[model samples]
Target: MAVVSAEPVKAMKEGQILVTGAAGFIGFHVAQHLLSSGREVVGLDSVNNYYDPSLKQARIDVLKQQPKFSFVKADLANRETTKSLFAKHRFPAVIHLAAQAGVRYSLENPHAYADANIEGFLNVLEGCRHHGCGHLLFASSSSVYGANTRLPFSVQDNVDHPISLYAASKKANELMAHAYSHLYRIPCTGLRFFTVYGPWGRPDMAIFIFAKAILEGKPIRLFNHGNMRRDFTYVDDVVEAIARLIDRPPQGNPAWSGDNPDPASSAAPWKIYNIGNNRPEELEHVVALLEKEFGRPAIKEMLPMQPGDVLATYADIEDLARDVGFRPATTIEDGIARFSKWFREYQN
Candidate 1:
């Protein structure tokens, strides 16, 4: 594995950064951080109803309060619209976080995944290519590890077998990025995020669903009969990693060899890193923590594992640490407690 040199990061130009999916969970937080750090941000999102539009609007509402932030209501699948936005702004840096999310949902709505993840990503790459964007940082997923039985998923591992369309799409994104990097010399970084959770998280995610169900006195469904594990990374930690990477795009590796090519790096200006907690927590333990935070026991309803689901996911974040000197440190207990507090206040 090649070690990413700890080079001094370049400073981003104020008011020239573009953040897609600014209305979504991680996007919202990342945009907020950029704004707070004195960078002007143009946030774009379709605000689709994949989950609840109300939640998305609420996030946008908060961002609108920041004078340095501007919001654009547009879908990335619309190539003309995306192109126009890029041409109009001529942004130097773009954070591409917009996508049709959810693993199980991908199984049911396969075309949505293709439209948003594939077509949308193409538009982003084209925009960066034509507009001379300095750096393009996009979100990948831990689910890209797919059927690999590896204990800790590393970016260097081959990920050719994706059980779910969502995972396949994310893997495709990384490949597409590499192609662009090789051909156009666009510095691109792909971040494979683990199970991210926190305040303003998607309602379809396990943590939000469990918290809502427990609070409403409804039974919480335990998939795989409570035999699942995940590297539940906190939203803030994910945001910090992204913020640091914004200014530190990868330089092409001169020693990259085709004989034993590393999946995480290339001769082109491209790189891949896993942003995760590096601590896999069992589902049962997560429930206990949530119960403790909620001050009520959950009505557990055990069930078989759903299709398009994995038994466990753990991330090897050594590369991220070596490059950025940061790791996700928030424990599940503290993360859930903070989320629970937000949920209670938001409900009232």
Candidate 2:
């Protein structure tokens, strides 16, 4: 399915949209889509060296070419600065995507998760509350489903046993957003993105790492002996879901009951959805696809499952499809081909 440009949002027609973490992979793509749709976008990012700042800068450069796009190099953890930006722009909608990503890295530097994911998210919620931002959409993660043995993780599932601080922080974001939504009546939507991949993807992610290792003739380490499964979603599909959701802010669910509450929805204007491919692929299959894309066999190193790593992730995107009338349709073959092409060009 083609990812079409979003329709003009009623509340956003008069003001610019704020895309936090705009320099980040998914955020960059989301901002670009919004900009291409003729929506004015103010992209905010700390541009920190969590990864290579050069890659973030490259994305910013592309956004800079668009006349309607503006960039703000600021950290969300800076409360005063975040407040100033919100007061200045009064964005109709805020897409909060900035966070300290990576489950494994959280073990090494736990404070980064607390500072960026918790404190930074608090700043965003406060901004939306004070500025009367029409809606607040933030990125949650599939990692939040930690320890749940369900075949496909759903928004309705209880996410109480997060194995990593990163997952816990994301869960905290959802809770905090719910509290703020209840108190301030700010329409809040949390998207639990599955294993998202494609062009301009994160270097630390599995696909990128495997591709790089294969190209350099390095051994690609496979956790759980390549037995894991993932619902690897394409970036364009994720972006399209976000774009379609911009205008459909949740109203307080009238059907919500305190007796047996739906974890995915609240009596307040808050909701959650899992945006994923809904098709789980084996880790071995992913590596094989990368090998084929590069036309080189990968030197594989079998390894035990790392702490905080789940064996599989399959998303139940019923809410996303029913609400947005769309679901991710990209096949792994096509998505990997596009990503490999981009990687080859990017390396050159």
What is the C-alpha lDDT profile of model 1 across 269-327, one tens digit per residue? Answer: 99999999999999999999888988999999999999988999999999999889899
Each prediction's TM-score versus the true structure: 0.98, 0.97
Best candidate according to TM-score: 1
Of candidate 1, the 10-residue stretch with the lowest lDDT total is: 3-12
Residue-pair clashes, model 1: 0
Q: List the residue pairs that clash in candidate 2.
A: none
lDDT of each: 0.92, 0.92
What is the C-alpha lDDT profile of model 2 across 1-348, one tens digit per residue? 112123535775668999999999999999999999899999999998989999999999999999999999999999999999999999999999999999999999999988999999999999999988988899999999999998889888899999999999999999999999899999899999999999999999999999999999999999998889999999999999998899878877888888988999988989899999999999899899999989999999999999999999999988888778899989999999999999999988
Off by over 4 Å in 1: 1-11
Q: How displaced is residue 150 in candidate 2, in Å?
A: 0.9
Per-residue error at 43 for model 1, in Å? 0.1
